[model samples]
Target: MSPSFRPRAPRPGPVKTQEELDEMVRRMKGEQKAPDNYRERSLKLHGWICAKCGREFDLANLHLLTVHHKDGNHNYNPPDGSNWENLCVYCHDDEHSRSILADYLRGDNRKK
Candidate 1:
């Protein structure tokens, strides 16, 4: 197949009815439950420091730091934080930008 001519496979998920889709949107917008406090726990487990740039954060500036999933799966939080890293906002943005650039270079435009 040509580079841009890959065949489209059927998406892998149960088909939802219209009402179910609407309800899901509503829940996501307003009534979604908390996502298991992984961020808070990861922050505590790894200290409020940027693993990328080694920047430190205190309570006053801690909001500038964010927990990043090393493997890019938010739902895969392990108690030991083996796949987590604390990165400052700038570093996190840079990391994502680099990933995007790499994907573009490799012609990987499809959503993962």
Candidate 2:
């Protein structure tokens, strides 16, 4: 190895306290970068309607609403909102109760 190639420092370990862990989870739950400006663009393109039931709504409903990916890829959140489909409060709750949501998103019931 060359003397100029120094090793990088190891990162700090995971949070020890419940509070710290919760904070980290909350931050990661939503993509905080750029304040989700792209989401607004999607809502506009889609007429801010719940794609499943054809229900119409405004952006403020976002507080109680969500955009779900049918194929389930958070990383593939539709930059143009094509991959996004609006979900109302009821539908959102129902979808998450299914195995697809539980297994992929929550990783619950996973074998240890």
Candidate 3:
């Protein structure tokens, strides 16, 4: 070891108050596994059928179907589910790939 090289002392971060810690825990619990109302509504509105592949889903394989945002804006949910479609996981991946391909053709190299 070089005598000139000294190890730096460990620094402590700013401590949160007990109230802040409690609030952080509460927020984490609320957001960690919250369900989306739009997904639930879309399922009820459109049923468990893939719009692209026309595959039907029931409670046995309901997880295979997913709600897709038509305009690619997930936050732009409509009450009528007009911007939402039920798609199988495979079709959803293909849909996103097509979107990416379109963007690439237009010289937009951003990855989604």
lDDT of 1 by residue, 3-105 (tens): 7877999899999999999999988888766568888988989998999899999999999999899999998999999989999999999999999999999
- Model 1 residue 101 CA deviation (Å) reads 0.4
Q: Lowest summed-lDDT stretch of 10 residues in model 2?
A: 31-40
Task: Compose the digit string of candidate 3's lDDT tens values, residues 1-112.
Answer: 6677778977889988999999999998988865558988999999989999999998999988999999889889889899999999999999999988988999999755
- TM-score to true structure, per model: 0.67, 0.49, 0.65
Better of 1 and 2 by lDDT: 1
Per-model C-alpha RMSD: 13.2, 14.0, 6.3
What lDDT does model 1 reach? 0.91
lDDT ranking of the models: 1, 3, 2
TM-score, model 1 to reference: 0.67
| Residue pairs whose backbone atoms clash in candidate 3 | none
